[model samples]
Target: MDKSIEKKYIPLAAYFEAATKDKITLTFSEIETIMGQPLPNASYLNVSWWKKTKPPLKHFTAWTTFGYSVTEIKLGYYVTFEKPTTDSTSSTPDQDSNDHPTYIIRSIELDDARDVIGLYQQLFAETDYMLYGQNENNVSVQSFRKLISKWKVENSGTMLIAIINGEIGGAIAIIGSTIPRKKHCISIKMGVLEKFTNYGIGTALMTEAENWARTRNITRLELSVMKSNQKAISLYQKFGFVIEGERKKSVKIGSNYMDEFYMAKVFD
Candidate 1:
């Protein structure tokens, strides 16, 4: 998947993201104009493709990510996008002028290994939802430096970290396989410090990951989330991920066996 192919739909996302009306409708031609491309054959032939559905279409994120849904579709004509009745349902960050957090998103560096490790230690201590506990991760900075070098050399993985107040606020990694057969598949892991939970750091990280995946020709992004971690699950769903299956007693925290869900988001 070339980045330009994915970028063609960005205009539509920007259009919807700037929407202020509760309900708006646009003709197929208008949408095409907004997207700078013609609609695919399925857009005219399959009504189901237009319905507001989960695991949305690859291009649908252009609207869905901005909190708009296709409430009604007229095949070969137009579609209606509406905001949810309650503002609580939207996963977008606050639209208020001063509500946005001040942070920068960037890829990791070898010299930052120590900080990254410190971040994971804090994350593990802050929550039990992570794969490793506070003391379980014994990775040395030297090993992490090697890992970072390998990821860069392979060009198949990305580990983005959010910088806030001169410190690492959060990190998100999309790890892909080197094997030709499984190159399209990627696994993701992310975390935000407790203090930055609702500041959109995670959302920004996910968006960047998806953008990177597109440029790299990755098609599937998957992750395992402990069943009890509903907050993380909801965030993932907002990004178009769906629960594909569950693993019973997949994680053991202390003596408690916890179930985890295998979730994935795919781009066609």
Candidate 2:
């Protein structure tokens, strides 16, 4: 995945990140000339064509990661990028300019194990939404180092990590298959520190992971989210992961039980 990391989209993301206003629009010719490529035909006819679907469209997350939204895009001449309608609904960072955090997205390496472990510790502490019990298992540098090395061998699993000012803000992993008949299936696990929840870090990590898996011809991407997590559920749905079923009382916290949904996206 590192050798194939999509570099073309980063420039587009940078343009939006540096914009000063709530909205910025560009002509098709302008965007094409700037991006140095031709636009896809579907991009002219369907708005859904711009969405971050499975197999992962190249440009979707680029505009989404920054504050700008792709509101109006068409064939003839133009596209629009607007600050999402309201603050609460926006995936944009919450802070004002001077203090706003800049996120760096990239694939994980063996040396990132220590920081990634610490990150999961902070994430598990933030909520009861994850599959793992808070503080139940200690995160170890050795364990993660070995896990990363194994990914190198299988070429079937991948983990993408997001960093904010040198700290790990979030990470997502897609583990490979163990069974012969289900060889194309993969399960996804993701966790983000609570403070970084709204900054599009999850979107970036998921897109990277999905793209990596899709590039390798994986057929199924699956995950389980605690039913109580509306935000996480919505995010999954946005990426076309549908709910196949739910398990009643699947997660136990204290004396109460919470439900979880088994969701997946199948690529054709």
Candidate 3:
């Protein structure tokens, strides 16, 4: 769960988060009691309320956060929450959310060099989503090692990778200035596999990276994101990053000139 995750649906999110059991059953009145509000009229009338896709009502995401599924819905009467059993018969340690990938978040290590390079290669191939495509990011292992080594040198930077069963789902890293004058600031970039978007890997990676930055006393963390990347911009904003300026017509891809947004997060 995200620390200080915004309570988009306040009472509902709190109720779901506090439950201790793998499965719990509740009646409509019971749920409404927990929510501290009456259920919406549409929630009771629409069959979609019981289904697990994007809830037309935002409050529905609460239980789904913990892998809760409405096993049986009696309309106005009751709802169920259960830990979905996987084909393995046991759920992966962190895979509580239904259909959510089980992933581990950790700081990158020296031994993970090959995996990191492979990730960059994969990201670079996604020409529509990244600044660097295959032709630009194709680098030798020696060169990439030097780059990561530079980030690691003198407390200047660090990387966080999201792994889902031995494969990198996404990755983010911060590069800090070692020079005394700019040591208070850092910047970063990240990408997830096209197939892995909306799985929360990007959010997890940024959460870990921000934790790392704060511990190192970084006061201002910044990044430049393509103006066209609204999803990335929204994620950055959620992490407290603010757009300070825009670089007009900065990136030229084919005949298109795309602007970039300069964003920063400042810690008090």
Candidate 4:
């Protein structure tokens, strides 16, 4: 049996400032322009926006549940590489071997958006809720194109894709912060291609995202899943996620209000 190394989950805030300034710098205006929305008042620059803002208080509620602590803002993961065990009789594993290398998770790059979107479409094209019911139509090629463009401009690194054998098999997109103060926290949207399910692809992508967020000092990772999607909920729970709350009749699908369960994991 192969030996395994100890892994750690680090807080995002510890590396956020430096990562933003040095790696992924995203301005508030840039994010708004890409997402096609205005910044909420409660954000870092607009403390008063929430008073008049509309629904989707997931972040606001999360912060309140955690006692308005700044440490509550974060949503990604990372991992470090450890030296292989010294077994004289054991031959070194190939570089491509999954067990051979340790990787630090980081934000999704724009160049990878296209492939990631394709993977999402493959996984969710037939689902009842398309893009979490945010889009009028089920996922389509055109929608993926628009999403990629938007992500490219927003500079949000939350979108991630798992690469195996040079192909993308799973993906996740973390929505931008609605409130100014909570901009650091992101809500995730995830999916794995039908054929890729049960193959560890989803876990790998999620692990990478969590590590990426930790590298930037992001403290929390939040997401909402359909009340009926038991498989996804199970996966989130296994990753140390907990149900913080729920939104009743939050999503509208075919004239029906579908409930959503909000789940979160705090790295700190």
What is the TM-score of each predicted model, taking all chains together? 0.64, 0.64, 0.63, 0.51
Worst 10 residues of 3 by lDDT: 2-11
- Residue 230, model 3: lDDT of 94
lDDT of candidate 1 over 49-162, digit per residue (tens) = 776355524677776776777888889888887777576544333442334444656677675688789999999999999999989989999999899999999998868887
Tell me the alpha-carbon RMSD of every candidate.
15.9, 13.8, 15.7, 18.2
Q: Using lDDT as the measure, name the better of candidate 1 and candidate 4.
A: 1
Better of 2 and 4 by TM-score: 2
- 1-268: candidate 4 lDDT, tens digit per residue: 0012111102121122112111122244322222223334445444333222233333332212222222221212211212233453343343223232212223444444445555555555557644442233355556665776676675454566554322455666766654567756767778766655676666877787776677755678899888888898989999999999988998877788888899999876
- Candidate 3 structure lDDT: 0.73
Model 4 CA deviation exceeding 4 Å by range: 1-107, 129-156, 178-180
Write down the lDDT that model 4 would get: 0.51
Q: Model 2, residue 10: what's the lDDT?
A: 56
Candidate 4 lands at a TM-score of: 0.51
Clashes of each: 0, 1, 0, 25
Superior candidate under lDDT, 3 versus 4? 3
**For model 1, the run of ten residues with the poorest summed lDDT:** 91-100
Clashing pairs in 2: 28-77
Ranking by TM-score: 2, 1, 3, 4
